[model samples]
Target: MIDAAWLNPVIAFSIGILLSFKLRKISARVQSRRGPLIWLPDRWHDINRSKVLQPLYDIIKLFSKQTIIPSTATPFFIAGPILALMCAVLATLFVPVAGISFDYSFSLVVLFYLLMGEILFIIMGGISSASLFSAIGGVREIDLMLANEIPFILGTFALAITFDTLSIQQMMGFNILINPFAALAVLLSIIVKLHIKPFDIPEADTEIVNGLTTEYGGKLLGVLETARIIMVFVLIALFVDLFLWIPSSGALAWVIFLAGVIATGVLIGFMNSLFARFRIDQATRWLFKIPLLVSVLAIGWAVLWRYVL
Candidate 1:
């Protein structure tokens, strides 16, 4: 039981790491060329003769590096990434993975609250960093929030309402028998919520080196990068619960679900690389209009299917 207790988080972290490596590979393949050669988790491991243990190399190199804070930046600047990462880890604790729940079933509600805290951390960390680019990134992040949040919330609410339960496991069980539209909403919202593509303008590289993360360096930056990647898996898992749910647990379900996520992410990234970032204002304007309408329509359709039909 103790091993079982630790297993879910370990798997979740491993999956998150694998996804980051996979994203690099997928992004490279999308550009029509082979990237680094394959190894245990990533093909990029064989880039040099020292490639066999590249994952270890990555961690050691990142963790041992210097964390630099700008001269003009406040004391909070040094601590912001750590705080954001802590919030991310705590949020993950609430997210049920691989049929494993936290200490109690009520942990689902805790997950929701923790997720909100992560968002708040992003806002605070970005603003407190004292960089012009970071501030702009913060504004764009908030704008992105305003644009897709309504759709996201309503989409989740639609699932919760239809299933009559906020617990992810219950929703997954219900999805197996009832509607597929909730699955559709989960897939679409994952893309938007992750800010994978066309929606990634908040941290557009052309405008901000790494968006709100421009100022962070060394290990601090690594934590933020890792957190972002972890979020990808977290969102993917949420989508899996909405769709591709299996009656009896099986590894195949996870495989199929992950494949779908990777495919969607690759497509989004390819599209993103092909186009220039839209102005922040333009992005929010379009997202608010199109996605919002689509979500409302989805909710209406789900209601009709459940009742008026």
Candidate 2:
């Protein structure tokens, strides 16, 4: 028998692919973390094939293609996306699916560190591609990381303070009710993390020829996409686990959790459709200036809830 947690990425990839059908109405581009997995026109669908599986098919197509590496890229090029996928899979063990997860006392901390490390790995891989465009994309990713990591920490930290624990397994409930601000802050940070519209400067595909992915092709690119689709599921599930309600067992619990995940994922994809990409300076400035304040207020609220109140 295999670990139950292994099913999450598969489920998430399916959901992401289903979501792309809707996302196609918004942006035909595949620049999102999971949105627009494949933008098939109405006429492009095969009558026998379900479009919901298109993302899966896309990955399969890439896996079947030849792998190519740039002459300028270092040995680390192959390692980067693999390492990032490892981070995502590791993080999955900490995030519950229908209240099933393998988490420890400080797993929340570990989860975040892994998510952050995933970015570093991607940056390492992207820059190693040695294309000037890839280099610029890496810089943009670093800048965006600096800007958003703050709110990401603060929002989750606020939750830690309120719950008085760092174990994610011990912190399941409708936490969004207790601190909507923190949840909102985390949600905003996720938009940046996943590179939705406006905050998508890091991989502004139209302007940078697919940004950090500019130099990647074939199986290498497929690995990156696999990591991406998995992370989308992992992060959205993390949000639901932390901020929404999910009982410890039963099929109903799974349904509720899946509903929440789908809703949230769609919300994120909707954001991807709503705004044009932001300039790097504007994006970073907005992230730091705006969500930071909400996160600060969330911390204050957490302090009051945990202590004074």
Candidate 3:
């Protein structure tokens, strides 16, 4: 537990940065683009960054730029990303990544709350920007969050009811085998939560400019992007922990866990390349429809198997 206090955030940040770069490369490959260069660069120019370090470089570049705060914006424009980044890294500590984590009852609940906080703060950043575009993006995000979180919770809790435990560590197993409906519901929710395509309503640049971060730049934008990178690490790791968990320990376990993460990222990248964006209403409706129904049904089924039958 004590070790997790320092190690978890360090792991999340370090690996999160690399995973962010790799995921971009994955997307680029799916689209048949060359992506970022793999070797260390000769000049560190923006146009041709080293594949492994490009995302980190982008963050540094953003940090070095001028930070502008609009007169209409509130202090939350400054506070939101910092809070959101804190929430993301904190959430990572609750998840078992290659057996390094802090575990106790209801960590799953805590994790969900933290992720919700992350989203809320991002929305706060947008709304505080005082741009109509940001407001519209915030509203769209609210809609997607409302529509997606219900199914996410339903699927997760259904598994909890089946396992009769609230601790994520206690809940580990081949969960997808036992509860495919819950699995599907959660996967769909993950796509929306990660803001992947087809469901990427809020950040649909074609419609809402840069969406939530439309009014942000410099260090603030860098902080927000850092938060996003951490989240990408956390959510995929959470799914692996919950649904495809390994029973081993030590170096081998770490290897398997990382392999799972990369595989999942690749899966998401393909989704990003293949699907077109969904309109806000369409996105919300899709979540509210089959995914929500399946989640509710999964919960009922789990209860029936666990308690009634």
Candidate 4:
């Protein structure tokens, strides 16, 4: 039997790959385009046909290429992606899969800081690159962080208060059924964090030429992409563990966990297809409004339910 310490990262990595394909297919279908083909007879077409493996292939291809650092880049430039990836992977340790999780009193706090650290590294990478586009992306990332962080914290606080514990495993009850407003707020905040459509202002490819990653290439870029893929799974799994807990034991629990992951991926892809990109100002204002208000109300409700009514 594999230790959960090792098994969790493998599961997370696999889920990330699956999500990449699911998102691609969903987005393609939404746009009335033929989604990825599963198989092709000819070797020439076979490479392109294995749609599920595209992300993996891309990563491998990136690794095979030569790395190029900008002449103006500081030593910290290389450290950025490495640090971001480390933080992202570390964040996964706190999330539970099928009732298996690391137990700690402040797991939630650790998860929060790990995520923040990942973004901070991205910002550092951008600024250190000494590229105009990277600088803009870094600034936008900071803007989005400021706009979404408070509401995210409030939403998590509501959960912590409702559950009366900071350990993620303890908070794994069907809290979404109880305090859906907090769940909604957290979901919205995650959308921003994941850089999904409309909220993808920081790395608006058209506007900033790939944003914070503009100066990154080759194996370094591959590392960043892999980290991002892992993060997609981490964030979605976190949401499922927090909001969509289903009552089951043993094998059944694993099935429900996977279903939740797929459902979340599809929802994210659908939303990405449905919305247009929001400007930075628009994104900031919108995040501060409904999600923040809902989070505040969720906190009030948690308090009331715990104490008064």
Candidate 5:
């Protein structure tokens, strides 16, 4: 029998993977023609006749590509992407996917630690590429992180305050019932955090020819792409837990949660496609100035709701 602990991670990963694929399918369908076949047609058959495996199949194809590194790239460049992917994957272990806390002793602190490492890995990968575009991209990432770190930390602290614990599992227990500004701030921050378009100035394809990833190709690109998708899933899960009370177990709850997440992704993807990329300075200034203030106000309101209400 599979251990319950192990089973939760599998379930969470599967959910994340499925949602990612579904978003891609939805995007393709929206863009105009039918996409590829769903991986499990029989399962969804007799229900909604829709394809859902394009994202997963695309990811698999990426991983199977021949590994190649530019001759001018640093020796460490080849391994950097894998390191980044590993850091993201490890983060999933710390997150309480199905609501069961495991290894509770370290689960709370481990997530922040892993997130820091993931950030470092990304910066390192960019720098180690030894290309000018990559170097500039690395610098841009550092700047972006610096600009947004305050709001991100404050928002996270707000969650900790709500739960009165640093543990992610404990944080999940606290529902976000107060302050629309806080939710909006965090929602916007997540978009910026993911560097989605309008905020994806650092990796501007028109200017830098792929920016930090300009030198990476083949399997390394695959690793980076997987890390990006996985992080997207993780962020959405965090939002769901923070904003809504997820049911312990039931078909309806699962469906509701899935729909909520897909809604978030669609909103984000639409924003990405519709908006033009911002200049780096403009993006940083805008996020830190207005959104940060809104987030602070949201927290203040939440505090009032807790005490004055």
Candidate 6:
């Protein structure tokens, strides 16, 4: 029997890979092209099925390549991706999936800090790489982080206030129905966190030569990519658990949870297709202004519902 302690990470990573395939397909369709092809045979009527395992293949290819660290980089350069991946995996442990969660008093708080640590390690890796582009990318990442952090925290705080608890498991309910405004605020914050279109300024390949990852390659880059894949799953799962009320146990619970994840992935992929990347200042201003206001309003509503009303 697989212990949940061992199973959760595998589940999270598998979901992440699946989401990546779906997102790629969505993006391709939006551009009027067929996306990844599955290995299974398509019917004679259907040609050009996109590769479902494309993301997995890409990661494997990266892993097979040789790593060449820059002569100027410090030992810490090697540690960055390692630490970032660790943080992402650690964060996944706290998130509930398929009605199973680690019972901790402050899982949400721990998740937030772990996510921050992931970002921090990425920044450190970029800066320590000693590449000019990487340094710029690291700086841009910091800028993006500063701009998004407050609203994200405020949005999450609204949820905490609404549930009157920081324990992730206890916070489960129909959160979207309870407070659509807070839910929207959090959804937007997550889009930024995922670095989707418009908010993808930190890694704008056109502007920064793939941004912080410009200097990363081979196995190091592979580790970072794996971390990103896992992060995608973790973040989406977090949102689903927080806002979408699925059954707490049984086979139905897993079905509902997976359906929610796919729905969220489709929505995000559509958004990514529709929007162009925002400039740093534009992205920061938008996040700080509208999302912040919505989050503040959410907090107020939570207060009213919990106390005055």
Runs in model 5 lying further than 4 Å from the true structure: 1-3, 7-13, 25-51, 101-109, 250-253, 306-309
Model 4, 181-256: lDDT tens per residue?
A: 9989988998999999989988999999989999999988998998899899998998898989887889999998
Stretches of candidate 2 off by over 4 Å are 1-3, 6-22, 25-48
For 1-309, candidate 2 gives per-residue lDDT tens digits of 777777766665566556545555345444444433334556656643445566778889999999989898998899999999888777777888778877688988999899999999999999998898989999999999998999999999898998889988788888988999999999999888888788878788888888898888899899898888777777788899889865657888888888888788768867887788899998888988889999999999999988997
Better of 3 and 5 by TM-score: 3
Which numbered prediction scores highest in lDDT against the true structure? 4
Task: Please give the lDDT score at residue 21 for candidate 1.
Answer: 60
Single out the weakest 10-residue window by summed lDDT for candidate 4: 43-52
Candidate 2 root-mean-square deviation in Å:
3.7
The lDDT for every candidate, in the order shown, is 0.64, 0.83, 0.87, 0.89, 0.69, 0.86
Pairs with steric clashes in candidate 2: none
lDDT (Cα, tens digit) per residue for candidate 1, span 182-257:
5555555566667666677767787687678778787877777666666766766666556555545568655665
Whole-model lDDT, model 6? 0.86
Off by over 4 Å in 4: 41-48
What C-alpha lDDT, on a 0 to 100 scale, does residue 36 get in candidate 5? 56
Clashes of each: 2, 0, 0, 0, 0, 7
Please give, for residues 46-152, the per-residue lDDT of candidate 6 as tens digits.
Answer: 75444676788889999999998999989888999999999998888888887686768788899999999999998898899888888888887888888777777
Model 5 TM-score?
Answer: 0.83
Candidate 4 overall lDDT versus native: 0.89
Provide the TM-score for each candidate, comma-separated. Answer: 0.84, 0.90, 0.94, 0.96, 0.83, 0.95
- TM-score (C-alpha) between model 1 and the true structure: 0.84
Q: What value of lDDT does candidate 2 attain over all alpha carbons?
A: 0.83
> Residues 1-309, candidate 5, lDDT per residue (tens digit)?
544555544555566677676556555666774655565457787775544555566678877888777677676686677787887787766655545435464464576667666766876877788888888887788878777766766676666655567766666632556446666776787787778777886688888777788887767888787777777776776676566545556666566566667777777766765677888888888878987897788777767766677
lDDT of 2 at 289: 89
